[model samples]
Target: MHDIRFIREKPAFFDKALARRGLGSVALQLAELDQRRRAAQTAFQEMQAKRNEASRQIGEVKKQGGDAAAQLAEVAALKEALGTAEIQEKALGKEIDDLLMGIPNLPADDVPDGKDETANVELRRNGKPPVFSFAPLEHDAIGERLGLMDFGAAAKLSGARFVVLKGALARLERALAAFMLDLHTGENGYTEINPPFLVRDEALFGTGQLPKFGEDLFRANTGHWLIPTAEVPLTNLVQGEIVDEAQLPLRMTALTPCFRSEAGAAGRDTRGMIRQHQFSKVELVSIAHPDASAAEHERMTACAEMVLQRLGLPYRVMALCCGDMGFSAMKTYDIEVWLPGQNCYREISSCSNCGDFQARRMNARFRGAGDKGTRFVHTLNGSGLAVGRTLVAILENYQQSDGAVLVPEALRPYMGGLDRIVPHV
Candidate 1:
């Protein structure tokens, strides 16, 4: 949510930021609505005061045994006028709020200018992509050859964009999640949380997923939304809260099954686990002091990169362009891992700094020891790593000549010391 006061004060700056996102000028319209709302509020206050004064006059006149009929009628008229003005004020306020809520957060000045991923600027590359002696197979092909990844079965059970992993493959997915959680919580200073998989509408709104991108999500019959990512729940932990400045940054992590309808994502990545209706991800969320959010964003991105580093996955960090950033992010960094089979990198995690956009929506604030007022807390969320995609990277990168996969040394303990995943008998 944007501050209307800011828009009122700096309409040009706000519109310029929106233009970078390919959005039309809305600051003028929003300012006009705000003006009308304030006018209505002023009218309401004046009418209310008039009615109070008239009532007081009526009482005084009756005390003196004089006629109060005129004052009574005037008070009644003012009462009706105030009611209409109050309604108009509320309606105009709601209109302004709706418009503000729909607008994406203004991109940070440091963000690159672009319309899509094609314009994203790569920051740095990590390990080199593994060399293959023979032709490397895609993750799906390798999994099918091992008779472990069953797409047909998943289709029968839950339709397309789904997969059923069995035997060592399934265990590998579990191991990936466990390893990510342990790494983030034990070493990265993030408190591990097990949040509800289903959330209320307010929770989604707090995270900028609802009232705009509702079609991208799945809803339960009970009216609760299936979490699209752990970011929703983890970030909302500080919703409507005001914390002490001492807790300048509160970091949390969760591994949860994410559900997405892929509403606008038709015919893209339809072949494998790359785009799935359901997948497990270890998400990281932080509530940080506004002054420190930029540094926190870098720290969070490094935490995610650490996961890929330990797995020895070749990846690159890219600073997302303004147009490619998420709805609530002022700035974002996407980590894309190398996939030899696909012969290109794919995004495995995105770390973003929301810069109080979500905090204003969630009413989350922080106060210092000597402060007389509170300020919105900056919010950040990132995928420590997507477990399914990590598994995909492992499968394609570690494929042996005989169709087996070598588990990464970092995940050996979680995999029960299993070094290799061979075809199931």
Candidate 2:
């Protein structure tokens, strides 16, 4: 959430920042609402003061043996007016809060100004797309040909955008998740966490996934929402908390199944596991001091890159334009892995530095030595790697001309020394 005082003092500044994201000016509207709220608050204070004075006067009149009826009536009137003013003040305050909550975070000054992903700038590319002797097949084609990925069975059991993996293919997906979690936890300074897959609305709101993207979530009948990523639970560990400066950088990792409704993503990547209702992922979250968040962001992105690096997969890092960033992120870097089957790169992870945007919403704070007050901690989250998509990349990139899939060497141990996925005959 944005600081109302900052928005009030620099309405023009915020308006310009919003414009960079292709949004129109909201400063005037916000200012007007703030003005009304201030007026209501002033009225309530005045009435409260009058009621106190009238009560004092009534007591003096009674002591002087004079009729205090008039003063008492006057006090009652002020009390009623104060009640109305209090209601008005609360309503106006809520309106301002709602508006602020709906607004996206301001883009960082260094973020390139643009309207969409097309305007994103590529920072670097790693590895090269493998060359195949014959025509390469998409992930679905290979999985289906092997008789291990069954979309028809999944659809009969559930619906579209679902798939059931069996035998080696299922094991490969599990291996990918385990490999990522071990890499992040053992080598990346991230403490592993087994977070709950279902969370409350407040947790989602703290992570900036509620009140705007509610349609994209899977709500359970028990009033809890299925997590879209482990980031939701992992990052929220500090919600409404004040951490010591000694623990300034708290790095956490988790691997879990994520559910999404994909509300607005119709007819896109529908043919494969790329866009699915449920998938497994290894998530990375960090809470850092304000001075260290930028450097931490770069380090976090590198950690995610290391996963693909170890797996020997081709990928690139993209600095998303202002309009392309998520609601809670001030700056974002999307890591897209090469998919030979689609002949293009698709997003496998997104690392973001929230710059206290989420901290403000969550009331997550840290106090420094000699500091008089607490300051919001900076929050960052990223996918170490999307497990299913990594599985997709592996199948397409490692496919043999005869339909066998070679396992990446890094995952050999996790796969019980398995080296290849031979087609089911």
Candidate 3:
């Protein structure tokens, strides 16, 4: 999804960025394919021009009342040549697209160079881990004891890594989602969107989810994929569009159920709802002018952080190093919420700025009044908050000694102004 023109101009910088991401030597391969594609296009154009000129010559001979047989023969030969050239050009076009689609987005200049999440540098830590008097129980143990969570029922209905919340817990989950959506649309400048949970292959490709990372998705019987996040639908709204510059920064948000196959993640956080086949999330997406994307990245992260902050949850923001970033993110910031039960912090949201990477794939662009030609709009998306994970964090952080869960003040209205979840079997 990288701009081939950028690679053509500065392969060194591109390769260096890739190197920081631990993807060694992609610039040379891309440059070679780009070269071959350009050569084929030029050759095919020359042949087509020759065929057109021969056709014109045949017409001129006939008009002069002379023998046009030689000119017609030449035209026929050129047409045959053009047919082959056209085939070659089309084949090259597909090949080049495939190559570019598989490439990851280049990391931003500020992203640190590292191998894994462990190397992620913390930017800010807010609030303090709560002090518990009694033996703190994990969210599952407390929920099960209180008859609010039922994993056994979930297993019978679906499979593992799933949970069925009853009574207050179910309401709490809904409240979390409602709270997030309200924060994004009611306060933030993002438009509210309701999109399809099931999308086609082309939609995924436009959002940089396909032609790579196919294993991470759940597909229907007919090959359509369930969305892993609302980001896919929200961000692809402008695919193949030429937007007016007046609407430069198009921000949109949605609350939807995300489905994932988790093919690569095994034996990791399988005990609880940490990794599930289905979860609810409030997602934020921006179609920004290239000049404003960098600033918008920070603003978007703050918007996500505000959710945890308003909930009075302890959390920290981490700047993900190059290797830890997602395939489509040039830069990313992860918001990790405090989990008192685990005595640590866990990621509840991630915001990314993909500067023109997905725009190129989708051919999403905007016109400028100045001399500058049409330019691709930058794209950004983040979990305003993962509803399921936020629920987990809240349960653990707000647990009472007597096994009741206190609802955060912000969610009181959503929960009918209830203060605590007093469970009854």
Q: How many residue pairs clash in each candidate?
A: 0, 0, 0
lDDT over C-alpha atoms for residue 94 of model 1: 90
Higher-scoring candidate on lDDT, 1 or 3:
1
Q: Please, what are the lDDT tens digits per residue for candidate 1 over residues 1-425?
A: 99999999999999999999989999899999999999899988888888888989988999999999999888877777787888999999899988999999999999999999899999999999999889999999999999999999999999999999999999999999999999998999999999999999999999999799999999999999999999999989999999999987999999999999999899899999999999999999999999899999999999999999999999999999999999999999999999999999999999999999999999999999999999999999999999999999999999988999999999899989999988888
Residues 1-425, candidate 3: write the lDDT tens digits. Answer: 87788888899998888889888787777788788888888999998888788888878988999998887887777787788888888898787778778889988889988989999999999999999998788888878878989999999999988899999999999999898889888999888999999998888998888978788999999888999999999888998999988887898999999999999788989888889999999999999999999999999999999999999999999999999999999999999999988888899999999998889888899997663678899999999999999999999999999889899999999999999987665
lDDT of the structure predicted as candidate 1: 0.95
Candidate 2 weakest lDDT stretch, 10 residues: 75-84
For TM-score, candidate 1 versus 3, the one ahead is 1
lDDT minimum window of 10 residues, candidate 3: 367-376
- Best-performing candidate as measured by TM-score: 1
Candidate 2 residue lDDT tens string, 354-376: 99999998999999877789999
Cα TM-score of candidate 1: 0.97
TM-score (C-alpha, index-matched) for candidate 3: 0.96
Residue 27 miss distance in model 3 (angstroms): 2.0
Q: In model 3, where do residues sit more than 4 Å from their true spots?
A: 60-67, 369-372
